[model samples]
Target: MHEGTALPGWTEMLVLAPLEWMELVGERLCVATCATVAYGAPSLGTPRPPAGMDYVRAYVLDSADTRELRALVEARIAGLADATGARELAGLTVRFRRLPPEDYASSWEKVWKPFRAGPFAVLRPSDRRALRATDVELRLEPGAVFGTGRHATTRLCLALLATRVARGERVLDAGTGTGLLAVAACKLGAGRALGFDIDPAAAPHALHLATQNGCADRTEWRTGGFEVLDAADAEFDGVLANIYSDILQAHAHELCERLRVGGWFVFSGVPDDHALATRAAFDAAGLRVETERTRGRWHAFAGRKPA
Candidate 1:
């Protein structure tokens, strides 16, 4: 799709496969469609798949070449069975449907309702819902990036930040998707917060979010990875990281070094399967794990840097 061009509609393609093959199928779909892929059940509102089977969905620009796309997807699926020797993959099928013309940009707003995360009430920029007297308001426009406060990892990090962020503290948010954590820290009374992500598109979205939340002056968004922090001094009072377990483990020492002595940190987005290994990495970096939280298959850790 061209930049800024209005989409007429979308051709939605769904591939049905078993649970174990969903990820591989989703990857192949992305390659075939040259777009992002999502995994879920066949039902609209259902979050998980039925028993062992799941659906992988992708969208292509509505055009006359849909049949070609379907053929390519089928070929990819067939190749998967040959590559993995999993003959069951050969049974997978790709279904296509043409969606009506509508504004796909704002369509998500119809289903993304406001929700509370710890002391903060997370809402869309256009939501007009009334807030309670004690509610700390956070306005977000969930673009292509992550950290919408709906994900369990984000909520867990927010809950931990609510308890740990002290007034006038300097905060660092690594892998700051929509700058939700950094902006939230500023809202929670932190003096300054700096957030960065490897995705080049992340900074603009995050800056807009900070401006919407009235914390742009106190928050800074940058485009890069942890190396962006290397030019600065090690003076952050708190750190927030909601990223993959492998990335967290790889940068544990670097993250710990950025904090001041006895400073606090919140680390989340680690699946339960990697919880023990992640904990070992944190401990190896000299962080004292003070609290551990789990929701579903995810885990979050809150702790402090030792003197």
Candidate 2:
């Protein structure tokens, strides 16, 4: 999908809310709309949102029914504010406007230019000019998290996998946002891979990406969280997760159980301050922390399940 092509009746809804509300409100908006959402700190030359507001942009199909959909979403967010004792949030508004398809795609293509993530060169299909013969190229779909490999946490996970993943081994990718890690594992010569996420919307898109990357035959995607795993399903030689620190600690044991004895597990999406506690949780889960990778405030841990 090259940028600047005419795409009629497309809309982008931009929401600028407090930075602290980005996660809370962003997750709600994502779950409710199932649309592509992007977040970032406001910068100069950008429309100044209220002080310290993080910007979120959601893309949706423009149609006759869109007005009603937008209203219902506004009401839902307003109701959330009331329920959370944050009635001040009732003042928050969702701005909806027609977006030029080319502009949208072009904007993303600029920020999401091809970048090396460990041994893989993560690129959009439009970036064929930069392809290198020796690099493992991952052609990703634009407009979503996880798929682009833009996050520091995701980069660290990829770096760890470059060292640990082995050819012909089976792997599990929990909280598989774009299923990038699973597809990358297959690209890295893993025999088979399973990717699942708590969000039902992720599986279909992830599978689509697997097909685009020519790894569909080797990858299976599903919707579920830790409960999706079974004791009998402990055949995986490796596991990967890039999830929040709290959730990582809570599910450390179950995540480890999915790996075979002596199998590898790489986890990230943790802030640096939480690294010690997260490592301790995994250590108590019968895994030994072999290495830790940090990028900015984010941290990733690579561990080996006990034999």
Candidate 3:
């Protein structure tokens, strides 16, 4: 738990692919692969991708099996490179670096230093200033979503919350990963912002984040799914969920139901490719899309409840 240096085997580079492709290959040599940033794959565009035909660099993980991973990449990904007969996606990248022993403590500490948004800054409270944003700040230990401000989903949610947060509006955050968005809601103007997640470990960090932002009393976070939430029976002015499309789609009806009549709903963490599927689910649930924004491979779609 003490500070340490990062590792030295992780690889990183950009990967360009056709806009039509879905779910490319990743390494099996490692237990998990995190997407540092996959840039330049927006869902909507008429301008063709570059014909240079080579992605600049790609970050990949192999853990102790770097050699095997390289071999697999050569046989599979390299072959795809050869098949670049199509030319629509050519500037994707994931700048990755292996975790050094101290990487967990140092680099993130450095990374969090520049997180500035509206009135929000993410910091350790103990540290001088790990994250510096707007008036309301959120402190996180840097877990699932990395330093917290770099994901497409996070950006999209922040934009939506900043726009509509109003005095006395009750807010609910579904699948509140890292608790960044929920903290944001408090600063943006929601009288109360409650967050829900199935992972119990997330509660403490979320609690700390809310406390750091001075929204601890108004912001309540707990461990449970929609089932537990269903019992509350109270409606909210807005609901924000930045989770996988599949899960969101499953809870479409319930998510829509949690909203007060004529209220707002903001959702993100959806890959660009899955927008259509999400749209379909929302449509099926009697929701109407009010605004949509996309960046790289991520998208945010907001809907209104017949207001």
Q: How many residue pairs clash in each candidate?
A: 0, 1, 33
TM per prediction: 0.78, 0.70, 0.69
Local accuracy of candidate 2 as per-residue lDDT tens digits, 1-307: 5456555455666677776566556545553445566786323577666776778766666663265778876776666677667655667777777754455544565666677988899887767675667788888876544556777788898889988888999999988988888888888899899998987767987888899899899988878988887766666899998988999999988887778899998899887557889999998989888898788667899979887
lDDT of 1 by residue, 1-307 (tens): 3468766677777887887766568667765435556666534764665677878887777764466777887788778888878888876777778877767656654666688989999998888988999898999886667665787789999989998999999999999998999999999999999999998878998999999999899988889988787655467999999988999999999889888899999999887668999999999999899999987568999999999
- After aligning candidate 1 to the native by TM-score, how far in Å is the CA of 2 from where it should be? 10
lDDT of 2 at 300: 93
* Alpha-carbon local distance difference test for all models: 0.84, 0.78, 0.65
lDDT of 1: 0.84
Q: Show pairs that collide, candidate 2.
A: 4-102
**C-alpha RMSD by candidate, in order:** 4.8, 5.9, 7.0
Could you give the candidate ranking by lDDT, starting with the highest? 1, 2, 3
Report the error of model 3 at residue 76, Å: 7.9
- In terms of lDDT, which candidate is strongest? 1
lDDT, residue 103, candidate 3: 42
Candidate 1 stretches with Cα past 4 Å from truth are 1-103
* TM-score (C-alpha, index-matched) for candidate 1: 0.78
Model 1 / residue 79 / CA error / Å: 12
